[model samples]
Target: MAKRQLVPTVRLRRLALELRQLREQAGMSREQVADATGMNRATLYRIEVAQAKPQGRTFQALLEVYRVPEARRKELTAILKSAHQQGWLQNTDDLPSQYAALIGFEAEAMRMLNYESLFVPGLLQTENYARAAIAGSAPDMSAEDVESRVIARMERQARREPPQTLKVVLDEAVLRREVGGPTIMREQLRRLLDDSERPDMTVQVIPFSVGAHPGMTGSFVILQFADEDHEIVYLEASTTDLFLESKGDVYRYRRQFDRLCEQAATPEATRDLIASELSGLK
Candidate 1:
């Protein structure tokens, strides 16, 4: 029995995407390749979907069948090797598998553009605020599970070195909603102010006066990788998540974000807004 990859890394997904592309370029179907290599079609499908990591022999066989150049095959082999290496989140059990992938993506991103309409972005969330949000959203989760999730989120924020460039735009409603009551909300606002002071972080707010905006639909994050080709947009919902990688989807989101930047308050003004909200909490 082949071991399934419970947690697939971004590199692994990229490798899998390449393999699927290679097969298509060769004009071979999954059944054809499975028959030629004595691999199961289901296994091939799993590999392509990134649910299973391909073994070295499997990869070599596929490359040979595809007639890939020796140099290209070596480069792909290196990618496969790196993909097999587990990320920090691989061992975490409390987080949903989909959300865990988002953390992995966040870890590798060079910059992140986040737009929030209701709640604070997870990367910038304070501990108590996170606890409150998590608890409210998943009322059935055990106390231990909630704590584990909070710790995992904070760890994600802490793991970055030289800190990733984080630009966050929030709706005014996010500032006014008291997640964990007055005290916790005040602390959360203060934390936001402090975070904006960092050179690598930018915080902005879109006031109610702006009325309607492109982001009214919901919140999403665009993660930009060091390799521009790897950029993706992540959409989170109450029950499911979606990852968008096509150039068209990414471009649309990028343009929406630009429009958001235009509508949002400046960083200095955002800080003042947060401070005013904090004072009103008294």
Candidate 2:
């Protein structure tokens, strides 16, 4: 008999769903819950969506406010505690602190939609590419630091099954930018072509000809779980990361994705564009 694999996310996501359901059952808005527990709405939002790991006190306060029964509180708290312990990159602090939780989330995500307006998405980057990009950005990081980050990124790709769905929308400028110079950039684009051929992957290019598109604001990733929970939107900037799980905000992002898709070349055409770009690098 095969051993059961523990997916902490499954537990955390369940907790989140339960939390949200309880609030809904009580006919309370997020603001109402905030008023009840004296917790900020943003914090409550993250907790209910499993985007942030709530402290034990915070979870208890949340349960108190949501009126969760004593019978189920123990089980839910245990689940939350266990999920918080399943950190794969605990020893590797080389990666950005802001990215640690996101990396863990990526490991458990069933579907990931990534849009890169500047550089390649971390999940798809090769070791050399990862090293080059990291080193270039953080000149003070040690060689060992850069390598560990690369190893962590590579590990994300070694999945038993490819992500159930991967839609990567790359801006034309990302392809044109020489992050690691011509040779590395060419290989990177070729790798994109290779990865896109996988059954679970879809790659699209937002061509320069499109002029401007929905993703013009910035690069963001919208992750969908198989459990039909609220979608998560990850927005990044120069110094901060934002995780949005509000249904309204998620819907707005979904609309932006639709617009980006509309403006981008078709998947088949995207493959051709990537091929043409690869040839240009030769």
Q: Give the winner by lDDT.
A: 1
> What overall lDDT goes with each candidate model?
0.84, 0.76
Summarize candidate 2's per-residue lDDT along 1-282 as a digit string, tens digits: 996533325346656666776789888999988998888999888877777677888888888887888977986787677664422222233225335457655655788888889888887787777888988988988999788878877877775266467888889998888888888898888888898798988888899988967788889998887645646677766555666666687789888888888888998998899889889885
Q: List the residue pairs that clash in candidate 2.
A: none
Model 1, C-alpha of 48: deviation from truth (Å): 16
133-213 in candidate 1: lDDT tens per residue? 999988998999899989998998897655589999999999999998999998999999899899999999999999999
TM-score, cand. 2: 0.67
Each prediction's Cα RMSD?
12.2, 12.6
Q: Model 1 off-target regions past 4 Å?
A: 1-11, 14-95
